[model samples]
Target: MEHVTDTPTVKAPAERFTGDVFLHPIATPAEPARLAAALVRFTPGARTHWHSHALGQVLHITDGVGLVGTRDGNVVRVRAGETVKCPAGEEHWHGATDATLMAHLAMVVGDGSGDGTSWLEPVTDEQYAAALAGPGR
Candidate 1:
């Protein structure tokens, strides 16, 4: 095994995120590996846009509390040490709660594509508000 250097943190793209979000890329293996991982941090109320992975994604909460929602109006609260799995091609969004910062290790399994996520529109404020109002799982 080879040693890896510390990676830089970058601001998440505004087009794909709401509020303040940052990403510290952890792993991006060569082509045949088809995997990518990152430590994603979200400020209170920050969230990702609607997106789906070609294969699927797994998230392990690292700090604070987070919300993961789907297009079907389901929102689940995930805390530190908790893990979430999103099936292939399931449209979803996730981020910090209204008053808590959240961080998670996001591991994405791709479908041989360098970029396997199909990023969709931003989740509307109404959608987010409704999610927060609903009960968490």
Candidate 2:
């Protein structure tokens, strides 16, 4: 068994998110034997841009409420203690709701050949607003 050393926390990129957000990388691609995990904190209305994983991604909600949206027009409201599985290459976006702060442990599974994630463009305000408007609005 190998013990990992403590690592410093890092601020999430402003370009990748909105509002106050932070990320703590628990593992990385370099450690393929281990799953890549990130502690993600989102301020009210903060969220990630639409993206996908080459392998897939799992999210376990730690606190508050989160919203996960898909290109097929599915928006799921996930709360603390809930686990969400996003299938490989499924275009999706996730973030905190407008009224709450949210945090989740995001796990990105490594592809045997590397190239585990593929990040797309940021979610446009128009898309977000439309999502907030609810279905058939």
Best by TM-score: 1
Best by lDDT: 1
Clashing pairs in 1: none
lDDT of 2 by residue, 12-93 (tens): 7777676678898877766537478889999888899888988889999999987889998898888999999999999999
Ten residues in sequence with the least summed lDDT for candidate 2: 128-137
Q: How do all models score by TM-score? A: 0.95, 0.87
Predictions in order: lDDT: 0.92, 0.83
Error of 2 at 12 (Å): 1.4
Positional deviation of 82 in candidate 1, in angstroms? 0.6
